[model samples]
Target: MILEQAILNIKPEESIVFEKAFAEAQKIISSMPGFVNLDLLKCIEETDKYLLLVKWESIEDHTIGFRQSEKYNEWKQLLHHFYDPFPVVEHYETVISI
Candidate 1:
């Protein structure tokens, strides 16, 4: 499995709205091909910060399949504007898991 992670810095005071929007946006991603699952985490110290983790079958499933699909546009519309400076997404493969 491929793990996709992004550190999202939402606009100040917009966390609540962002979370609500994400609830709807999650449906879009969950329906995509190669999607395994996802988790959205909020930071205790920084209320405006969030961590989005998604599991996919392969990198191409995200980079090509999702990003290049029309559904990505919907995803972007629903949640991208909440990001302050935009998030940098990275992918990982598990080296060890217990």
Candidate 2:
């Protein structure tokens, strides 16, 4: 599995709005090929910050398949504007797990 991680810095007081948008966006991504699951996390110290972890069958399924699809545009439209500066996204593979 491939894990895609992003630290989203949302605008002040936009958590509720972003959460709603994320719920909608989740449905879209979940329907895509190779999608395994998604998790949205919030920072206790920073209310405006969130972490998005998405699991995919492979990197290509997310980087190439999802990004190139029309649904990505819709996803961006729903949630991208909430970010002050776009978050940086990174990918990882599991090394060890208990």
The model with the greatest TM-score is 1
Q: Itemize residue pairs with steric clashes in candidate 2.
A: none
- lDDT against the true structure, per candidate, is 0.97, 0.96
TM-score of each: 0.98, 0.97
Clashes of 2: 0
In model 2, the runs with Cα more than 4 Å from the true position are none
Q: Which stretches of candidate 1 lie over 4 Å from their true place?
A: none
* Residues 1-98 of candidate 1: C-alpha lDDT, one tens digit per residue: 99999999999999999999999999999999999999999999998999999999999999999999999999999999999889999999999999
How far is 81's C-alpha from truth in model 2 (Å)? 0.3
Instruction: Report the C-alpha displacement of residue 18, candidate 2, in angstroms.
Output: 0.7
Q: What tens-digit string does per-residue lDDT give for candidate 2 at 5-97?
A: 999999999999999999999999999999999999999999999999999999999999999999999999999999988999999999998
